[model samples]
Target: MSHPVILFEGVGKKFRRSLKADLLYGFQDASRSLFRRKPLEHLRSDEFWALRDISFTAGAGECIGIIGPNGAGKSTLLKLVNGDYRPDRGRIAMRGRIKSLIRLGTGLQPMLTGRENIYIQCAQLGLDKRATDATLDEIVAFAGLEKTLDAPVRHYSDGMYARLEFSIATCLPTDILLVDEVLAVGDIAFQIRCLERLDSLKCNGTTVLFVSHSEMTIRHVADHCLLLFDGEALAFGETDKVFLKYYQSIGYLDRQLKPLGTSPEIPADFAGVASIRALAVKGQENAGGVKVFTGQPVDFEVSYFASVPVDSAGLVLQFWNQADILIATTHSDTDGHRLSLKPDGGRLRLALPFLSLIPGIYRVAGGFVSAGDWLGYGGHLLTLVVAQKQGQAYEGLISIEAKVSNAE
Candidate 1:
C-alpha cells in the first residue's frame, strides 16, 4: 500500500482581498467588482494568497499536525484538503475516505431539540438511520446530557452545544480525519473523552490531520508536524523537530522575550485609542519562577489601566501554535461574561489551571474595553513560549479526572 494516504502536490490557494474604492466596499469590490464580487478576503492589496506552492505528504497511518500564527492559512489548508475550497494551483490526492470536523453542527437548526439535532447532525455526517441508532446511546452518554437530549438546543449552554457537535461528528469514524480546533470546543472532561476516541481511531490505522493553536492537542495526537509561516510550509518532519523550529523562531526559550502582557507590542502602522498595562505570565503557584510544563498550573496575568469606566470590558487570550493560527481562545466579555475596568485600575487574569498547553511557543494578549466600547485595548498583546523536551510527555491542558470503570 502507498505509505502516504494524503498528498498535496504543489497546492496553493489565493484570495482576492481588495480595497473598495467606494469606502464601503473596500478596494476589492471596486477593482473588478463588476465581474467577480465574491468576498475578497485573504487577499493582499486586493489579492491575498493564503497558501502558495505548498507541498507535503502524510503516510497511511500518519497523524500530521498543522500549526501557525493567526491568518496564516492553517484553516485554509484544511479547507482546501477537505474540498471545501478549490486550490488556485496544484492538486490534492487522497487514497481513502475524508471527513472534516471544522465547525461542528454548522447546519444545526437552533429551534430543533437535541434528539432531533442528533438525527440532523448524523445525516450531515453521512450516517444513515440504522448507523445513528447504533451509536445514539453512546453519543448521549458521552455527552452526559441524556436528560437534556430531548430539549431544544437553543437553551443549551456553550458546552452542551459543543457536546452535541462532538457526538454527532465522531459517532461514526472515517479515515483522513480533518479537525480544526474542534477538540477544544467541549469542556475539559468531554475533551478527554473526545481525544480518547480519536486515539482509538488512530490506533485503528486512521490517518488524521489536525489544525490548531494548541500545542498540547497536536503533541498528544499527532506524530508528525508541519509548521506553517505566513501560509507556507516552514518546517515539516518529526513532530518534535518541527515544534522545536517553531519555538526557536518565536524566541520561546529566551527569558527576556516579553510577550504581550499588560500592554502588547503593536506595529507602528496600527491605529487605536487605548492603552495597555502590565502583562506577565508566571507559575500559578510560584508567581516568580519560569519553566512550566503541561500539568503545572500557570497564570497569564494582565493588569490594564482604563482611562474611563466602561460598562463592558473584554479580555481575550489567544493561544497560537508555531504556525500562528489561534488554536484556543477564552474571552472574558463575549456573551459569557463582561467586566468593567474603571479609570482607577483593573486587573484581569486568564488562568490555565493545569496548563494543559503542550510544549510550544504560546502567545498571550490583553484586550481591554471600558464603558462598553472597543477602541483598541492592544492587539496581539504579548507572546509567551513553552518548550518540548525529548522523552517528556504531558497531557494537553487540564487533564480530566477519571476513575476506573469496573464491572459490578
Candidate 2:
C-alpha cells in the first residue's frame, strides 16, 4: 500500500475570544472597559475552539473534501494544513510541496502591476524569471486578463484578482494543493477549465485538500471525506459512504427519499444572487409532511443570508425531471424589492398560495439576489408527491374560482 500524502493527527486550533467578554457587564458598565488592564483581555472570553482533535489521511492522487455547516471549522481545518495557523495542540504531516489557495496573492506587491506580481510570485515559488516569462502568457490567457496584465493589480476586479492569483498559485508543479471554493471566481468556462486542471493534476500524483460546503462537488471530486462540526472531525472515510451519511444527516434523504434510493440534493437553489449557506424543505411533522403530493397546498420556503447586501435578490425555482429540464418555476418575486432589501442581514421569504406542482421527484431551482447580484447555484429543495386522487379542490393555479352557469 502507498503512504498517505497528507495526514492530520489530533489537529486543533483555538482562537482568542473577541471583545464581547465585557458584555457580561451591563451597558452602563461599558465605560469601565476602557481602563481595563487589557481591552483585548475582554476578547479572551470569546475564545473559540475552531478545530478539535481532527485525524485523517489522503494518499497520492486523492482529493479529500472537508464539509459542514457554517462555523463548523471547515475553513480552519484547511488553514491548519495550509500553515496559516498553528494548532494549539496536535500535528499535521505533509508529503509534498503544498500550494495553498488560502489567500489571493500571498506575496503580492502592492505597487506592482499584474505582470510584475506574476513574475514576483513565480520567483518566490522558486521559478527562474525565464520560467516565469515562459508561463506568463498561459497564465494571462487562462485568466482572460490579457488586456489588464500590464495594469496595476490595484485596478483589478475581485474576479480578476482571483483569476490572476489562482493562475499564479497553481502554475507550479506542486505535489499537493490546498483549495478553497475559489472556483466561484471566474466565468463558467474558466470554472470548468479549473476543475479539469485539478483532475489532470490529481491523475499525475498531486494530492488535493478541498474545502467547501458543496456536497456535490465533494462527492464528485473527493476520494475520501472528512466531515467537520464545531471545529472537530465528525466523520471520515470513503467519499461515497461518508458523503451519503452527511446528506442524510442534513435531511437530503429520509431513509432514501421514500420513493426509492434517491438522495435529495439542491444543485441550484439560488440561481441569481450571491448564493446561500444552504436550503431545505420541511412542513409540520404531524401535518403528514413526509412526502408532498401533486396539487396539494404544500409550502416552499428558501432561507439564505448574504456575505454582503447585494443590490438585488431573486430566485428561479425550476422543477426538473430526471433528465433535468425546467418543468416550471412555481414562483417568481421580481417586484423590484428583492434587489434592494435594506439592512445587510435581511432575508427574503416567498410563499406560494397554492402549489400546482406535478410530483415525481421534481427538482427545485431559482435565483436569489440581494441588492442585484445573482448567486449561480442549483438543486432540489424537496421531492414532492402529487396525489393522483383529487382530494379537495383549491381556488388557485388549477383554475380561478368563478361559477359558470348553463345560461352563461
Candidate 3:
C-alpha cells in the first residue's frame, strides 16, 4: 500500500524584521514551546510571518514543486523540511533518508579536492566507503570533471562546481530529494541531463521536493504544486490549477490590462537623475493600451523627466514572460546608441521591425542609467498582449526566421 512520505500539518514559521528583535523573539518562542503553550499567532512589532498555516502532504513517488516570487517563503518551507529550521508551530513528518541540494557548494569545502569532496558529501549522507567507491567514477563522469576531480574545489568555475554538486547530491538515490534553484546551473545540455536524472528518481519511487523559477521545468516533473504568497499558502493541488492560480495572482491572465497610472515602487537608491513618467507601446493598428499581434511593427516608448542634463545616460528594455522569467533584454549601451537627455524631459523610442513573440502576455520593464549608475528602474511597468498571427502556428515563445534547403 502507498503512503505519504512527507507531511506538514498547520506549519507556521515566524521571523523578525530586526536582528536583535529576531533573537529576542526567538528565545520567547522557544520558552513558550518548552512550556507547552501556544505561540502567538498575531503579528507583533518588528516581527513577520515567513510561513503561516501551511499544510501539504507528498506521498511516495510524488514530486512536489514549490514556487513564488522572491521572499515568498518557498526556500523557508524547504529549509523546514530539511531540518535546517524548525517550525514555530506545527509538525513535519518524514519517513525516510532525505537528501537536499538546496544551494551550491553547501556541503563542499573550498580547500578540498573534488574527489575528496564527493567522498565527504556521501559520508555526510551516511554512505560508507564501499558505496562511495561504487559511485565515484559515475559521479565524476556525470559532472564531466574528470581532469579536475583531483584539483581543489576553489579552482573550479561556477559551472564545474554546480555540476559536481548536483552530480554528488543525486548520485545515490534516497527516499526524499529536496532541490532548490540548483537546476539553473551548468550549460543547457547539463540541465537537460539533470532533468532526466530527476525523472528517473521519480520513477524509482523517490518523494521529491523541487523548487525553481522556471515554470516549464516545474510543470514537467511535478505531480503536484504549491503556491505561496505573503507567508501564506494561497493555493495547493494539481500542477495546472496551482500554476493558473499563481499566474492569476501576478495579473498574468487578467483579461483587462491594469491602468498605467504610476510605476512600480522603485528602490530608494534608484531615484536621482531621472523619473520614468509614462510607458506606452504603439503597434501598426493599435494605439497602445495592451493588445498587439505577432508580426506587427511595435514601437515601445519610455517617457521620462530628467532633473539634470546628462550625456552618458542609457536606457534599457527588458521583456519577461508570464512566469516572471526574463527572456530578453535590449540595452542602448550594448547597441552603441548614446542618449543626450535635456533638463526638462524627453521620450526615448525603441522601434521593433516586427514583434516576433508568440501569442501570450509579456511584462515590459524600463530602466535608466547615467554615468554607470542606475538613476531610475521599474519592473512590469507595462503589459503587452501578442495575439497569434493569421497564417502561422509557431511552436515556441518567439518565432525565428530560418530557411530549409535540401542538398542533393
By lDDT, who's the top model here?
A: 3
Shift of residue 10 alpha carbon in model 3, Å: 1.6
**TM-score of structure candidate 3:** 0.62
Best by TM-score: 3
lDDT of 3 by residue, 45-156 (tens): 8866688667789988889999878888899998999999988778898999888888787778999999899999989878899999998999999999999999999998
Clashes of each: 39, 47, 0
Q: Residue 231 in candidate 1 has what lDDT?
A: 60
What TM-score fits each model?
A: 0.57, 0.55, 0.62
Error of 2 at 38 (Å): 26
The sequence of per-residue lDDT tens digits that candidate 2 reaches over residues 1-408 is 268888777775666554454355334245555555322212134455566567777888888887777877877887878777776567788876888886665556757899989988898899998998899999888888888878888887767877888788777668889888776666778776777777878888889988876665777778877765455454577676556545433444443333553333444344333554344454432111124444445555555555555555566566654344344564345554444434344455556555554323344555553333345565655443232222232221123324577984
Q: Rank the candidates by lDDT, best first.
A: 3, 1, 2
Error of 3 at 275 (Å): 32
Candidates 2 and 3 compared: the better one by lDDT is 3
Steric clash pairs (candidate 3):
none
Better of 1 and 3 by TM-score: 3
RMSD of every prediction: 17.7, 18.6, 15.4
Give the runs in model 1 whose Cα sits over 4 Å from its true position.
1-3, 19-45, 255-408
lDDT of 3: 0.77
Which of candidates 2 and 3 reaches a greater TM-score?
3
